[model samples]
Target: MSLTHDATLRELPTEHGVLRYHEAGDPGAPPLLLLHGSGPGVTGWRNFGANLPLFAEHFRCLVLEFPGFGVSDPTDQHPMVAALPAVGRFLDALGLEQVDVIGNSMGGVVSTRFALAQPDRIRRMVTVGGMGRAIFSPSPGEGLNLLMEFTEAPSRERLIEWLNSMVFDRALVTEQMIEERWAQATEPSTLAAARRMYSRAALEGMAKAASTSPEPPYWAMLHQVRARTLITWGRDDRVSPLDMALVPMRTIPDAELHVLPNCGHWAMIEQKSAWEAAVLAFLTRKD
Candidate 1:
């Protein structure tokens, strides 16, 4: 069967819940796990669907829908907290001992955390923004603020504002895109989960807790990532901002950085060909 979005739709029951994913490419090919961001209406398909055909040509592409995103089963734990275990379970379910990864925003953070925790499971990784701290730029940058705003109150206007911030070229935010996102973003279960992650109260609570937590933040531990990593960013990313990539680029022992100009938070989608070229080269490189 040919690979297409609907044709690739699949689900696997895991200890966490029913894990929904899109699978393409030969089952015999090396697996490539694609993880999506934490935007209000985000899903695995929405984030990486367009890139699947190209990636599937070389590797088995599995776009995982993280828990609490409406596409996957809902969980009481924060989505980020639920994500790590979901990844492990999904891989275990598929009998994939190790695989390459491509993560966007929140997914990047999750992938980094997973690599640190299970050093042997990730052969290589690529992250499109959201892997580090804001050394110079303001915390919770423009795109995040808009995201929180939309999560706090669901409105077509707010969703539009957030979508516009995702790409450097506003033209990418089409009416159909807005409508699809709006429908999903407003779903009662999805919106509630989003609040747990992006509401002002949640952000404040997390900050206050992090202030007293004994553990150092993940960015401080980037030096420990064992996998070869490609840290891709958009020069115009308003969400995480370009400065955030500095720490990961400089710290990850086996890492390289690529920043595409005239792009924003969604580098993989906004600068599709260039991002794919960079990622494919890194993943397939032998040195």
Candidate 2:
């Protein structure tokens, strides 16, 4: 039988508000906190939807809903850095001293920041297509504009086309995926929340942080992280290309990297078997 839905729904009262989380598998198993990317329809489940059942069998997986995403309460602040405190609060509320942290894209940036600020709280780190230095072909804002246009477009096909632009494989853009994303993106609060999040200053601030943070960019930080690390990427990812991950593989002494060929940005969804195998192998390593 599948795990009970209630078994996965959990909440933690933080200083900001009550954050919603989904926990699966044995409560006493080792802990893993999963963080999702930032996008028009991002949520923890959307990021790891395909890997949940597999991860549940081995680890106590907690999928976090970031502020303004999913069912979580919106924060007064705009930038993600402002929300790091809440992550710390969630960890404290759960009475967890340390946890394995896994994140993608924007969430990866937040995870890296949290680890840097509170290194003692992180046990192991795994980042898939995680953030790093700025890589702009046109402009960073162009990506946001494309998503916004397609998300607000009246025609469903156009929306799917725009969504598919982020991935290498068009077949992965199923109707169910588009409908699910549209439902979340068109929620009453999403526009207002996104407006706050992408104000010119907020975007500029994020750009600056990406370009000039004193701490090692994600790659540099990978070297300093005391915990064992695993890095995975989709070979055909359009958003954060695997071409950029090469330097990090050499820098991190204890890190292992896996690339899923023919997969797109959503490795968890497109090539789940390989992704799960890599993740489980890393987590179970006795070294």
Give per-residue CA lDDT, model 1, range 159-262, as digits (tens).
99999999999999998898888888888888888999999999999999899999998989999999999999999999999999999999999999999999
lDDT on C-alpha atoms for all candidate structures: 0.93, 0.72
RMSD (Å) per prediction: 0.8, 3.1
Q: Judged by TM-score, which candidate is best? A: 1
Cα lDDT, model 1, residue 270? 94
- The lDDT leader among the candidates is 1
Q: Compared with the true structure, what per-residue lDDT tens digits does model 2 show for residues 67-136? A: 8764688766763654577788888888889999888877777887787778888888887874554343
Candidate 2, run of 10 with poorest lDDT: 133-142
Which regions of candidate 1 fall more than 4 Å away from where they truly are? none
| Residue pair clashes in candidate 1 | none
